[model samples]
Target chain A: MNLTDQQRTLIEQIGVWHENNGIQPAAARVMGLMIVSDKRELTFDEITEALSISKSATSNALNLLLRTEHLEYITFPGDRKRYFKMKISNWREAFTRKIDDLTGFNVLLRQVLEVRNRNCDESDEGLQDFISFLDYLHQELPNLLAKWEEQNKKS
Target chain B: MNLTDQQRTLIEQIGVWHENNGIQPAAARVMGLMIVSDKRELTFDEITEALSISKSATSNALNLLLRTEHLEYITFPGDRKRYFKMKISNWREAFTRKIDDLTGFNVLLRQVLEVRNRNCDESDEGLQDFISFLDYLHQELPNLLAKWEEQNKKS
Candidate 1:
Protein backbone atom coordinates (compact mmCIF):
# COMPACT_ATOMS: atom_id res chain seq x y z
CA MET A 1 0.00 0.00 0.00
CA ASN A 2 1.04 3.60 -0.70
CA LEU A 3 1.88 6.13 2.05
CA THR A 4 -1.34 8.07 1.49
CA ASP A 5 -3.48 4.97 1.92
CA GLN A 6 -1.62 4.04 5.09
CA GLN A 7 -2.12 7.50 6.62
CA ARG A 8 -5.69 8.13 5.44
CA THR A 9 -7.14 7.36 8.83
CA LEU A 10 -4.51 9.46 10.61
CA ILE A 11 -5.25 12.40 8.38
CA GLU A 12 -8.98 12.04 8.92
CA GLN A 13 -8.50 11.70 12.68
CA ILE A 14 -6.34 14.84 12.90
CA GLY A 15 -8.77 16.70 10.70
CA VAL A 16 -11.65 15.88 13.04
CA TRP A 17 -9.56 16.79 16.07
CA HIS A 18 -8.72 20.19 14.62
CA GLU A 19 -12.34 20.78 13.66
CA ASN A 20 -13.38 20.05 17.25
CA ASN A 21 -10.91 22.70 18.36
CA GLY A 22 -12.70 25.26 16.13
CA ILE A 23 -10.50 25.20 13.06
CA GLN A 24 -12.15 25.56 9.68
CA PRO A 25 -12.65 22.20 8.01
CA ALA A 26 -10.38 22.89 5.03
CA ALA A 27 -7.59 24.30 7.16
CA ALA A 28 -7.91 21.41 9.61
CA ARG A 29 -7.58 18.97 6.72
CA VAL A 30 -4.48 20.80 5.56
CA MET A 31 -3.00 20.57 9.06
CA GLY A 32 -3.68 16.86 9.22
CA LEU A 33 -2.21 16.34 5.76
CA MET A 34 1.00 18.05 6.84
CA ILE A 35 1.30 15.99 9.99
CA VAL A 36 1.02 12.60 8.34
CA SER A 37 2.92 13.25 5.17
CA ASP A 38 6.19 11.29 4.84
CA LYS A 39 7.68 13.86 2.50
CA ARG A 40 8.37 16.47 5.19
CA GLU A 41 8.45 19.44 2.86
CA LEU A 42 5.70 19.95 0.26
CA THR A 43 5.19 22.73 -2.24
CA PHE A 44 1.87 24.36 -3.09
CA ASP A 45 1.07 21.97 -5.91
CA GLU A 46 2.01 18.92 -3.89
CA ILE A 47 -0.25 19.93 -1.01
CA THR A 48 -3.16 20.57 -3.33
CA GLU A 49 -2.79 17.24 -5.04
CA ALA A 50 -2.33 15.20 -1.86
CA LEU A 51 -5.45 16.53 -0.18
CA SER A 52 -7.79 16.48 -3.20
CA ILE A 53 -8.65 20.07 -2.24
CA SER A 54 -8.87 22.90 -4.73
CA LYS A 55 -6.11 25.43 -5.29
CA SER A 56 -8.15 28.22 -3.74
CA ALA A 57 -8.85 26.16 -0.61
CA THR A 58 -5.23 25.00 -0.37
CA SER A 59 -4.06 28.60 -0.70
CA ASN A 60 -6.42 29.80 1.98
CA ALA A 61 -5.52 26.96 4.34
CA LEU A 62 -1.80 27.57 3.78
CA ASN A 63 -2.20 31.25 4.55
CA LEU A 64 -4.11 30.50 7.74
CA LEU A 65 -1.44 28.06 8.91
CA LEU A 66 1.28 30.56 8.06
CA ARG A 67 -0.42 33.36 9.98
CA THR A 68 -0.79 31.08 13.02
CA GLU A 69 2.97 30.24 12.77
CA HIS A 70 2.21 26.54 12.71
CA LEU A 71 3.80 26.15 9.30
CA GLU A 72 6.59 27.93 7.43
CA TYR A 73 8.00 27.76 3.93
CA ILE A 74 11.51 27.32 2.60
CA THR A 75 13.02 28.12 -0.84
CA PHE A 76 15.82 26.28 -2.57
CA PRO A 77 18.77 28.48 -3.56
CA GLY A 78 17.82 28.42 -7.26
CA ASP A 79 14.21 27.33 -7.07
CA ARG A 80 11.38 29.86 -7.11
CA LYS A 81 8.78 27.66 -5.40
CA ARG A 82 8.39 27.55 -1.61
CA TYR A 83 8.24 24.27 0.33
CA PHE A 84 6.22 24.33 3.55
CA LYS A 85 7.02 22.43 6.74
CA MET A 86 5.78 22.47 10.34
CA LYS A 87 7.40 24.87 12.80
CA ILE A 88 8.19 22.14 15.31
CA SER A 89 10.53 23.95 17.71
CA ASN A 90 7.89 26.37 19.08
CA TRP A 91 5.49 23.61 20.21
CA ARG A 92 6.34 24.28 23.88
CA GLU A 93 5.61 27.99 23.57
CA ALA A 94 2.35 27.43 21.71
CA PHE A 95 1.04 24.93 24.29
CA THR A 96 2.03 27.15 27.25
CA ARG A 97 0.44 30.17 25.62
CA LYS A 98 -2.93 28.36 25.56
CA ILE A 99 -2.84 28.28 29.39
CA ASP A 100 -1.56 31.86 29.70
CA ASP A 101 -4.22 33.13 27.31
CA LEU A 102 -6.89 32.00 29.81
CA THR A 103 -5.84 34.88 32.05
CA GLY A 104 -7.30 37.27 29.51
CA PHE A 105 -10.48 35.20 29.23
CA ASN A 106 -10.81 35.21 33.02
CA VAL A 107 -10.59 39.00 33.05
CA LEU A 108 -13.41 39.13 30.51
CA LEU A 109 -15.45 36.71 32.63
CA ARG A 110 -15.05 39.06 35.60
CA GLN A 111 -16.32 41.92 33.52
CA VAL A 112 -19.21 39.76 32.32
CA LEU A 113 -20.07 39.02 35.93
CA GLU A 114 -20.09 42.69 36.92
CA VAL A 115 -22.44 43.58 34.12
CA ARG A 116 -24.58 40.55 34.94
CA ASN A 117 -24.96 41.81 38.51
CA ARG A 118 -26.40 45.17 37.41
CA ASN A 119 -29.66 43.69 36.18
CA CYS A 120 -29.76 40.76 38.53
CA ASP A 121 -31.50 40.64 41.92
CA GLU A 122 -29.42 37.54 42.53
CA SER A 123 -26.23 37.40 40.53
CA ASP A 124 -25.57 34.40 38.33
CA GLU A 125 -24.22 31.67 40.61
CA GLY A 126 -22.65 29.62 37.85
CA LEU A 127 -20.72 32.66 36.59
CA GLN A 128 -19.32 33.21 40.07
CA ASP A 129 -18.28 29.57 40.27
CA PHE A 130 -16.66 29.74 36.86
CA ILE A 131 -14.75 32.92 37.75
CA SER A 132 -13.37 31.43 40.94
CA PHE A 133 -12.35 28.28 39.12
CA LEU A 134 -10.48 30.31 36.49
CA ASP A 135 -8.91 32.43 39.22
CA TYR A 136 -7.60 29.31 40.92
CA LEU A 137 -6.18 28.14 37.62
CA HIS A 138 -4.52 31.49 37.04
CA GLN A 139 -2.93 31.38 40.47
CA GLU A 140 -1.82 27.75 40.43
CA LEU A 141 -1.33 26.36 36.88
CA PRO A 142 2.07 27.99 36.48
CA ASN A 143 3.19 26.71 39.83
CA LEU A 144 2.17 23.22 38.82
CA LEU A 145 4.15 23.42 35.58
CA ALA A 146 7.17 24.86 37.38
CA LYS A 147 7.13 22.10 39.96
CA TRP A 148 6.96 19.57 37.18
CA GLU A 149 10.00 21.11 35.55
CA GLU A 150 11.87 21.10 38.86
CA GLN A 151 11.06 17.47 39.53
CA ASN A 152 12.07 16.47 36.01
CA LYS A 153 15.41 18.33 36.42
CA LYS A 154 16.18 16.44 39.61
CA SER A 155 15.15 13.11 38.19
CA MET B 1 -34.21 50.89 32.64
CA ASN B 2 -35.74 47.45 32.71
CA LEU B 3 -33.66 44.34 33.53
CA THR B 4 -33.41 43.14 29.91
CA ASP B 5 -32.13 46.50 28.65
CA GLN B 6 -29.58 46.66 31.43
CA GLN B 7 -28.28 43.19 30.54
CA ARG B 8 -28.26 43.52 26.75
CA THR B 9 -24.50 43.75 26.51
CA LEU B 10 -23.92 41.01 29.08
CA ILE B 11 -26.18 38.73 27.14
CA GLU B 12 -24.41 39.54 23.89
CA GLN B 13 -21.01 39.05 25.48
CA ILE B 14 -21.94 35.69 26.88
CA GLY B 15 -23.62 34.68 23.66
CA VAL B 16 -20.45 35.41 21.74
CA TRP B 17 -18.32 33.66 24.37
CA HIS B 18 -20.37 30.49 24.12
CA GLU B 19 -20.40 30.68 20.34
CA ASN B 20 -16.61 30.81 20.41
CA ASN B 21 -16.71 27.68 22.56
CA GLY B 22 -18.75 25.95 19.80
CA ILE B 23 -22.27 26.27 21.24
CA GLN B 24 -25.08 27.17 18.84
CA PRO B 25 -25.80 30.92 18.85
CA ALA B 26 -29.43 30.56 19.89
CA ALA B 27 -28.57 28.21 22.75
CA ALA B 28 -25.75 30.52 23.80
CA ARG B 29 -28.12 33.50 23.93
CA VAL B 30 -30.49 31.46 26.05
CA MET B 31 -27.62 30.58 28.36
CA GLY B 32 -26.75 34.25 28.62
CA LEU B 33 -30.34 35.28 29.31
CA MET B 34 -30.56 32.80 32.15
CA ILE B 35 -27.36 34.16 33.69
CA VAL B 36 -28.39 37.83 33.70
CA SER B 37 -32.08 37.74 34.54
CA ASP B 38 -33.35 39.47 37.67
CA LYS B 39 -35.79 36.62 38.17
CA ARG B 40 -34.01 33.44 39.20
CA GLU B 41 -36.70 31.19 37.81
CA LEU B 42 -38.26 31.69 34.39
CA THR B 43 -41.21 30.05 32.69
CA PHE B 44 -41.16 29.14 29.00
CA ASP B 45 -43.09 32.26 28.03
CA GLU B 46 -40.77 34.53 29.98
CA ILE B 47 -37.67 33.10 28.31
CA THR B 48 -39.25 33.48 24.91
CA GLU B 49 -40.33 37.09 25.57
CA ALA B 50 -36.95 38.19 26.93
CA LEU B 51 -34.90 36.81 24.03
CA SER B 52 -37.46 37.58 21.27
CA ILE B 53 -36.57 34.20 19.81
CA SER B 54 -39.16 32.03 18.15
CA LYS B 55 -41.08 29.58 20.32
CA SER B 56 -39.34 26.64 18.69
CA ALA B 57 -35.89 28.16 19.24
CA THR B 58 -36.63 28.82 22.89
CA SER B 59 -37.94 25.31 23.38
CA ASN B 60 -34.93 23.77 21.70
CA ALA B 61 -32.47 25.87 23.67
CA LEU B 62 -34.20 25.07 26.92
CA ASN B 63 -34.14 21.38 26.10
CA LEU B 64 -30.43 21.58 25.24
CA LEU B 65 -29.68 23.28 28.56
CA LEU B 66 -31.78 20.72 30.40
CA ARG B 67 -30.01 17.81 28.75
CA THR B 68 -26.61 19.25 29.70
CA GLU B 69 -27.86 19.75 33.30
CA HIS B 70 -26.95 23.42 33.07
CA LEU B 71 -30.54 24.34 33.67
CA GLU B 72 -33.32 22.52 35.50
CA TYR B 73 -36.95 23.09 36.32
CA ILE B 74 -38.94 23.41 39.55
CA THR B 75 -42.69 23.31 40.07
CA PHE B 76 -44.83 24.40 42.98
CA PRO B 77 -47.20 21.91 44.63
CA GLY B 78 -50.34 23.05 42.81
CA ASP B 79 -48.89 25.00 39.86
CA ARG B 80 -48.45 23.09 36.62
CA LYS B 81 -45.92 25.30 34.86
CA ARG B 82 -42.22 24.41 35.21
CA TYR B 83 -39.79 27.17 36.13
CA PHE B 84 -36.33 26.86 34.63
CA LYS B 85 -33.33 27.94 36.68
CA MET B 86 -29.58 27.51 36.50
CA LYS B 87 -28.20 24.52 38.39
CA ILE B 88 -25.85 26.37 40.71
CA SER B 89 -24.61 23.51 42.87
CA ASN B 90 -22.50 21.57 40.41
CA TRP B 91 -20.14 24.34 39.25
CA ARG B 92 -17.02 22.67 40.64
CA GLU B 93 -17.89 19.32 39.14
CA ALA B 94 -18.65 20.86 35.78
CA PHE B 95 -15.35 22.75 35.74
CA THR B 96 -13.15 19.89 36.99
CA ARG B 97 -14.80 17.51 34.58
CA LYS B 98 -13.33 19.65 31.79
CA ILE B 99 -9.84 18.78 33.01
CA ASP B 100 -10.67 15.12 33.45
CA ASP B 101 -12.13 15.08 29.95
CA LEU B 102 -8.70 15.91 28.53
CA THR B 103 -7.62 12.39 29.48
CA GLY B 104 -9.96 11.05 26.83
CA PHE B 105 -8.64 13.48 24.26
CA ASN B 106 -5.04 12.56 25.07
CA VAL B 107 -5.84 8.89 24.57
CA LEU B 108 -7.21 9.66 21.13
CA LEU B 109 -4.11 11.73 20.32
CA ARG B 110 -1.95 8.71 21.20
CA GLN B 111 -3.97 6.55 18.86
CA VAL B 112 -3.76 9.16 16.13
CA LEU B 113 0.00 9.31 16.58
CA GLU B 114 0.34 5.55 16.23
CA VAL B 115 -1.56 5.56 12.96
CA ARG B 116 0.40 8.52 11.59
CA ASN B 117 3.69 6.72 12.21
CA ARG B 118 2.57 3.88 9.99
CA ASN B 119 2.87 6.08 6.87
CA CYS B 120 5.75 8.26 8.00
CA ASP B 121 9.53 7.92 7.76
CA GLU B 122 9.75 10.46 10.63
CA SER B 123 7.00 10.92 13.22
CA ASP B 124 5.23 14.26 13.71
CA GLU B 125 7.35 16.41 16.02
CA GLY B 126 4.52 18.64 17.26
CA LEU B 127 2.36 15.63 18.08
CA GLN B 128 5.21 14.28 20.18
CA ASP B 129 5.53 17.62 21.94
CA PHE B 130 1.80 17.85 22.61
CA ILE B 131 1.62 14.29 23.99
CA SER B 132 4.41 15.05 26.42
CA PHE B 133 2.69 18.25 27.52
CA LEU B 134 -0.58 16.44 28.15
CA ASP B 135 1.20 13.59 29.87
CA TYR B 136 2.79 16.15 32.17
CA LEU B 137 -0.59 17.70 32.86
CA HIS B 138 -2.18 14.33 33.54
CA GLN B 139 0.59 13.43 35.98
CA GLU B 140 0.75 16.73 37.85
CA LEU B 141 -2.49 18.77 37.57
CA PRO B 142 -4.27 16.68 40.23
CA ASN B 143 -1.29 16.95 42.54
CA LEU B 144 -1.34 20.69 42.06
CA LEU B 145 -5.04 20.90 42.91
CA ALA B 146 -4.48 18.72 45.97
CA LYS B 147 -1.63 20.97 47.12
CA TRP B 148 -3.83 24.02 46.81
CA GLU B 149 -6.55 22.37 48.90
CA GLU B 150 -3.98 21.47 51.55
CA GLN B 151 -2.60 25.02 51.65
CA ASN B 152 -6.11 26.42 52.02
CA LYS B 153 -6.79 24.14 54.96
CA LYS B 154 -3.57 25.19 56.75
CA SER B 155 -4.27 28.86 56.26
Candidate 2:
Protein backbone atom coordinates (compact mmCIF):
# COMPACT_ATOMS: atom_id res chain seq x y z
CA MET A 1 0.00 0.00 0.00
CA ASN A 2 1.18 3.51 -0.91
CA LEU A 3 1.68 5.86 2.04
CA THR A 4 0.64 9.48 1.79
CA ASP A 5 3.12 12.21 2.69
CA GLN A 6 1.29 12.93 5.94
CA GLN A 7 1.34 9.21 6.87
CA ARG A 8 5.06 9.12 6.11
CA THR A 9 5.68 12.03 8.47
CA LEU A 10 3.65 10.42 11.26
CA ILE A 11 5.55 7.18 10.81
CA GLU A 12 8.83 9.06 11.02
CA GLN A 13 7.78 10.70 14.27
CA ILE A 14 6.82 7.37 15.81
CA GLY A 15 10.12 5.92 14.61
CA VAL A 16 11.97 8.72 16.41
CA TRP A 17 10.08 8.07 19.64
CA HIS A 18 10.89 4.36 19.53
CA GLU A 19 14.50 5.01 18.58
CA ASN A 20 14.86 7.33 21.57
CA ASN A 21 13.55 4.50 23.75
CA GLY A 22 16.56 2.34 22.65
CA ILE A 23 14.96 0.52 19.73
CA GLN A 24 17.23 0.19 16.69
CA PRO A 25 16.24 2.45 13.76
CA ALA A 26 15.13 -0.21 11.28
CA ALA A 27 13.00 -2.11 13.81
CA ALA A 28 11.57 1.13 15.12
CA ARG A 29 10.63 2.17 11.58
CA VAL A 30 8.78 -1.09 11.08
CA MET A 31 6.93 -0.47 14.34
CA GLY A 32 6.10 3.03 13.16
CA LEU A 33 4.71 1.70 9.90
CA MET A 34 2.64 -0.93 11.72
CA ILE A 35 1.16 1.57 14.18
CA VAL A 36 0.08 4.15 11.58
CA SER A 37 -0.96 1.77 8.85
CA ASP A 38 -4.56 2.40 7.79
CA LYS A 39 -4.97 -1.26 6.90
CA ARG A 40 -4.26 -2.25 10.55
CA GLU A 41 -2.81 -5.59 9.45
CA LEU A 42 0.01 -5.92 6.90
CA THR A 43 1.73 -8.83 5.23
CA PHE A 44 5.53 -9.20 5.16
CA ASP A 45 5.87 -7.70 1.70
CA GLU A 46 3.55 -4.85 2.59
CA ILE A 47 5.65 -3.89 5.66
CA THR A 48 8.95 -4.16 3.76
CA GLU A 49 7.71 -2.05 0.82
CA ALA A 50 5.96 0.53 3.04
CA LEU A 51 9.03 1.06 5.22
CA SER A 52 11.49 0.66 2.31
CA ILE A 53 13.65 -1.59 4.51
CA SER A 54 15.77 -4.51 3.28
CA LYS A 55 14.28 -8.02 3.45
CA SER A 56 16.70 -9.15 6.19
CA ALA A 57 16.05 -6.05 8.29
CA THR A 58 12.31 -6.59 8.04
CA SER A 59 12.66 -10.27 8.92
CA ASN A 60 14.86 -9.53 11.97
CA ALA A 61 12.58 -6.73 13.18
CA LEU A 62 9.49 -8.88 12.77
CA ASN A 63 11.18 -11.72 14.62
CA LEU A 64 12.21 -9.42 17.48
CA LEU A 65 8.74 -7.89 17.67
CA LEU A 66 7.12 -11.28 17.66
CA ARG A 67 9.45 -12.66 20.36
CA THR A 68 8.88 -9.57 22.50
CA GLU A 69 5.09 -9.78 22.04
CA HIS A 70 5.07 -6.36 20.36
CA LEU A 71 3.46 -7.90 17.27
CA GLU A 72 1.20 -10.86 16.50
CA TYR A 73 0.02 -12.51 13.32
CA ILE A 74 -3.33 -13.47 11.85
CA THR A 75 -4.04 -16.11 9.28
CA PHE A 76 -7.26 -16.26 7.24
CA PRO A 77 -8.79 -19.44 5.86
CA GLY A 78 -6.90 -20.78 2.82
CA ASP A 79 -4.49 -17.84 2.94
CA ARG A 80 -0.77 -18.61 2.77
CA LYS A 81 0.26 -15.10 3.83
CA ARG A 82 0.30 -14.13 7.50
CA TYR A 83 -0.97 -10.65 8.30
CA PHE A 84 0.63 -8.83 11.24
CA LYS A 85 -0.77 -6.21 13.64
CA MET A 86 0.52 -4.37 16.64
CA LYS A 87 0.03 -6.25 19.92
CA ILE A 88 -1.69 -3.61 22.01
CA SER A 89 -2.02 -6.07 24.90
CA ASN A 90 1.76 -6.02 25.06
CA TRP A 91 1.69 -2.42 26.31
CA ARG A 92 0.03 -3.43 29.55
CA GLU A 93 2.10 -6.60 29.60
CA ALA A 94 5.25 -4.52 29.34
CA PHE A 95 4.22 -2.42 32.34
CA THR A 96 3.32 -5.55 34.24
CA ARG A 97 6.71 -7.04 33.48
CA LYS A 98 8.40 -3.85 34.65
CA ILE A 99 6.51 -4.05 37.93
CA ASP A 100 7.69 -7.64 38.28
CA ASP A 101 11.27 -6.54 37.64
CA LEU A 102 10.96 -3.89 40.32
CA THR A 103 9.69 -6.55 42.67
CA GLY A 104 12.64 -8.80 41.90
CA PHE A 105 15.11 -5.97 42.28
CA ASN A 106 13.51 -4.99 45.57
CA VAL A 107 13.91 -8.53 46.80
CA LEU A 108 17.58 -8.48 45.88
CA LEU A 109 18.01 -5.12 47.61
CA ARG A 110 16.48 -6.54 50.77
CA GLN A 111 18.92 -9.43 50.72
CA VAL A 112 21.79 -7.00 50.33
CA LEU A 113 20.36 -4.91 53.14
CA GLU A 114 20.20 -7.97 55.37
CA VAL A 115 23.90 -8.69 54.85
CA ARG A 116 24.88 -5.06 55.28
CA ASN A 117 22.77 -4.66 58.40
CA ARG A 118 24.37 -7.72 59.92
CA ASN A 119 27.91 -6.43 59.35
CA CYS A 120 27.49 -2.75 60.16
CA ASP A 121 27.11 -0.88 63.45
CA GLU A 122 25.28 2.02 61.76
CA SER A 123 22.21 1.40 59.68
CA ASP A 124 22.16 2.50 56.05
CA GLU A 125 19.15 4.80 56.27
CA GLY A 126 19.20 5.61 52.58
CA LEU A 127 19.10 1.96 51.54
CA GLN A 128 16.41 1.34 54.14
CA ASP A 129 14.28 4.21 52.80
CA PHE A 130 14.75 3.02 49.23
CA ILE A 131 13.60 -0.43 50.31
CA SER A 132 10.54 1.10 51.93
CA PHE A 133 9.71 2.87 48.68
CA LEU A 134 10.16 -0.33 46.71
CA ASP A 135 7.99 -2.18 49.20
CA TYR A 136 5.27 0.43 48.81
CA LEU A 137 5.41 0.09 45.04
CA HIS A 138 5.30 -3.69 45.26
CA GLN A 139 2.22 -3.57 47.45
CA GLU A 140 0.42 -0.96 45.37
CA LEU A 141 1.11 -2.35 41.90
CA PRO A 142 -1.15 -5.36 42.36
CA ASN A 143 -3.98 -3.23 43.73
CA LEU A 144 -3.62 -0.89 40.77
CA LEU A 145 -3.68 -3.80 38.31
CA ALA A 146 -6.76 -5.15 40.04
CA LYS A 147 -8.51 -1.80 39.72
CA TRP A 148 -7.61 -1.69 36.03
CA GLU A 149 -9.01 -5.18 35.50
CA GLU A 150 -12.19 -4.19 37.34
CA GLN A 151 -12.55 -1.13 35.12
CA ASN A 152 -11.91 -3.26 32.05
CA LYS A 153 -14.66 -5.61 33.15
CA LYS A 154 -17.06 -2.70 33.62
CA SER A 155 -16.25 -1.31 30.21
CA MET B 1 40.51 3.30 48.57
CA ASN B 2 41.15 -0.10 47.02
CA LEU B 3 38.44 -2.59 46.04
CA THR B 4 38.50 -6.25 47.08
CA ASP B 5 38.10 -8.97 44.46
CA GLN B 6 34.53 -9.61 45.65
CA GLN B 7 33.76 -5.91 45.42
CA ARG B 8 35.17 -5.82 41.89
CA THR B 9 32.95 -8.74 40.87
CA LEU B 10 29.88 -7.05 42.38
CA ILE B 11 30.66 -3.81 40.57
CA GLU B 12 31.10 -5.66 37.29
CA GLN B 13 27.74 -7.40 37.75
CA ILE B 14 25.99 -4.11 38.39
CA GLY B 15 27.70 -2.64 35.34
CA VAL B 16 26.45 -5.51 33.24
CA TRP B 17 22.90 -5.01 34.51
CA HIS B 18 23.00 -1.31 33.71
CA GLU B 19 24.55 -1.93 30.30
CA ASN B 20 21.72 -4.37 29.51
CA ASN B 21 19.31 -1.56 30.44
CA GLY B 22 21.13 0.71 27.91
CA ILE B 23 23.26 2.61 30.42
CA GLN B 24 26.87 3.22 29.43
CA PRO B 25 29.39 0.96 31.17
CA ALA B 26 31.30 3.76 32.84
CA ALA B 27 28.17 5.34 34.30
CA ALA B 28 26.95 1.94 35.39
CA ARG B 29 30.26 1.25 37.09
CA VAL B 30 29.99 4.57 38.93
CA MET B 31 26.49 3.65 40.08
CA GLY B 32 27.63 0.20 41.18
CA LEU B 33 30.58 1.64 43.06
CA MET B 34 28.37 4.15 44.83
CA ILE B 35 25.88 1.48 45.85
CA VAL B 36 28.44 -0.87 47.40
CA SER B 37 30.76 1.67 48.95
CA ASP B 38 31.09 1.15 52.69
CA LYS B 39 31.81 4.84 53.23
CA ARG B 40 28.71 5.73 51.18
CA GLU B 41 30.56 8.67 49.61
CA LEU B 42 33.59 8.83 47.33
CA THR B 43 35.75 11.54 45.81
CA PHE B 44 36.68 11.63 42.13
CA ASP B 45 40.09 10.05 42.64
CA GLU B 46 38.66 7.43 44.96
CA ILE B 47 36.07 6.38 42.38
CA THR B 48 38.63 6.29 39.60
CA GLU B 49 41.05 4.15 41.65
CA ALA B 50 38.34 1.78 42.97
CA LEU B 51 36.90 1.15 39.51
CA SER B 52 40.28 1.21 37.72
CA ILE B 53 38.74 3.49 35.07
CA SER B 54 40.51 6.33 33.27
CA LYS B 55 40.19 9.95 34.49
CA SER B 56 38.19 11.06 31.43
CA ALA B 57 35.76 8.12 31.58
CA THR B 58 35.15 8.73 35.29
CA SER B 59 34.64 12.44 34.68
CA ASN B 60 32.07 11.87 31.93
CA ALA B 61 30.19 9.17 33.88
CA LEU B 62 30.00 11.32 37.02
CA ASN B 63 28.74 14.25 34.98
CA LEU B 64 26.03 12.11 33.37
CA LEU B 65 24.97 10.61 36.68
CA LEU B 66 24.87 14.05 38.32
CA ARG B 67 22.80 15.52 35.50
CA THR B 68 20.40 12.58 35.63
CA GLU B 69 19.92 12.97 39.44
CA HIS B 70 21.31 9.49 39.93
CA LEU B 71 24.15 10.94 42.02
CA GLU B 72 24.59 13.92 44.37
CA TYR B 73 27.55 15.50 46.06
CA ILE B 74 28.40 16.67 49.58
CA THR B 75 31.24 18.78 50.95
CA PHE B 76 32.83 19.00 54.37
CA PRO B 77 33.40 22.46 55.89
CA GLY B 78 37.20 22.37 55.39
CA ASP B 79 37.42 19.96 52.45
CA ARG B 80 37.79 21.20 48.88
CA LYS B 81 36.84 17.82 47.39
CA ARG B 82 33.18 17.01 46.71
CA TYR B 83 32.21 13.53 47.85
CA PHE B 84 29.56 11.80 45.71
CA LYS B 85 26.84 9.34 46.75
CA MET B 86 23.84 7.75 45.14
CA LYS B 87 20.61 9.72 45.40
CA ILE B 88 17.95 7.50 46.95
CA SER B 89 15.24 10.11 46.29
CA ASN B 90 15.98 9.76 42.61
CA TRP B 91 14.70 6.21 42.67
CA ARG B 92 11.19 7.40 43.45
CA GLU B 93 11.73 10.34 41.12
CA ALA B 94 12.59 7.96 38.28
CA PHE B 95 9.35 6.03 38.81
CA THR B 96 7.42 9.29 38.94
CA ARG B 97 8.98 10.44 35.68
CA LYS B 98 8.06 7.09 34.11
CA ILE B 99 4.45 7.61 35.15
CA ASP B 100 4.56 11.05 33.56
CA ASP B 101 6.00 9.61 30.35
CA LEU B 102 3.23 7.01 30.26
CA THR B 103 0.64 9.75 30.75
CA GLY B 104 2.16 11.81 27.92
CA PHE B 105 2.35 8.79 25.62
CA ASN B 106 -1.28 7.97 26.41
CA VAL B 107 -2.34 11.47 25.42
CA LEU B 108 -0.49 11.13 22.10
CA LEU B 109 -2.03 7.69 21.54
CA ARG B 110 -5.49 9.13 22.17
CA GLN B 111 -4.88 11.77 19.53
CA VAL B 112 -3.78 9.07 17.11
CA LEU B 113 -6.87 7.06 18.00
CA GLU B 114 -9.04 10.09 17.28
CA VAL B 115 -7.57 10.61 13.82
CA ARG B 116 -7.58 6.91 13.04
CA ASN B 117 -11.14 6.59 14.28
CA ARG B 118 -12.29 9.45 12.06
CA ASN B 119 -10.63 8.03 8.97
CA CYS B 120 -11.50 4.38 9.38
CA ASP B 121 -14.88 2.67 9.17
CA GLU B 122 -14.19 0.18 11.98
CA SER B 123 -13.11 1.09 15.50
CA ASP B 124 -9.69 -0.13 16.61
CA GLU B 125 -10.56 -2.10 19.71
CA GLY B 126 -6.91 -2.77 20.53
CA LEU B 127 -6.02 0.91 20.48
CA GLN B 128 -9.09 1.70 22.57
CA ASP B 129 -8.15 -0.98 25.10
CA PHE B 130 -4.56 0.28 25.32
CA ILE B 131 -5.88 3.80 25.88
CA SER B 132 -8.17 2.51 28.59
CA PHE B 133 -5.18 0.80 30.23
CA LEU B 134 -3.19 4.03 30.08
CA ASP B 135 -6.09 5.99 31.54
CA TYR B 136 -6.32 3.51 34.41
CA LEU B 137 -2.58 3.91 35.07
CA HIS B 138 -2.78 7.72 34.89
CA GLN B 139 -5.57 7.79 37.46
CA GLU B 140 -3.89 5.32 39.84
CA LEU B 141 -0.21 6.42 39.79
CA PRO B 142 -0.80 9.66 41.73
CA ASN B 143 -2.83 7.91 44.39
CA LEU B 144 -0.10 5.30 44.77
CA LEU B 145 2.58 7.94 45.19
CA ALA B 146 0.43 9.85 47.67
CA LYS B 147 -0.07 6.72 49.71
CA TRP B 148 3.66 6.10 49.74
CA GLU B 149 4.28 9.66 50.92
CA GLU B 150 1.68 9.31 53.63
CA GLN B 151 3.25 6.10 54.82
CA ASN B 152 6.63 7.71 54.68
CA LYS B 153 5.46 10.60 56.83
CA LYS B 154 3.93 8.27 59.40
CA SER B 155 7.15 6.29 59.62
Clashing pairs in 2: none
**For residues B29-89, could you state the per-residue lDDT of candidate 2 as single tens digits?**
8887887666777899999988888999999999999998999999999999999988876
What are the TM values for chain B, all candidates?
Answer: 0.79, 0.85
User: Tens-digit lDDT track for model 1 on B12-87?
Assistant: 7778877887788888988778777666788998888888889999999999989888789999999998999878
Best by DockQ: 2
Q: What tens digits encode model 2's per-residue C-alpha lDDT throughout A29-121?
A: 888888777787899999999888888999999998898888999999999999998886677678778877777666656655543322454
* TM-score for the A chain of candidate 1: 0.79
lDDT of 1 by residue, A1-155 (tens): 13556577777777887888788988887877776766667899988888888999999999999998878999999999999987766565665677666766676667666655445434554566567666777787777667656765674
**Candidate 1 collision pairs:** none
Candidate DockQ values, in order, are 0.39, 0.43
Least accurate stretch of 10 residues (summed lDDT) in model 2 chain B? B114-123
Question: Candidate 2, DockQ to 2 decimals?
Answer: 0.43
**Each candidate's interface RMSD:** 3.6, 3.2
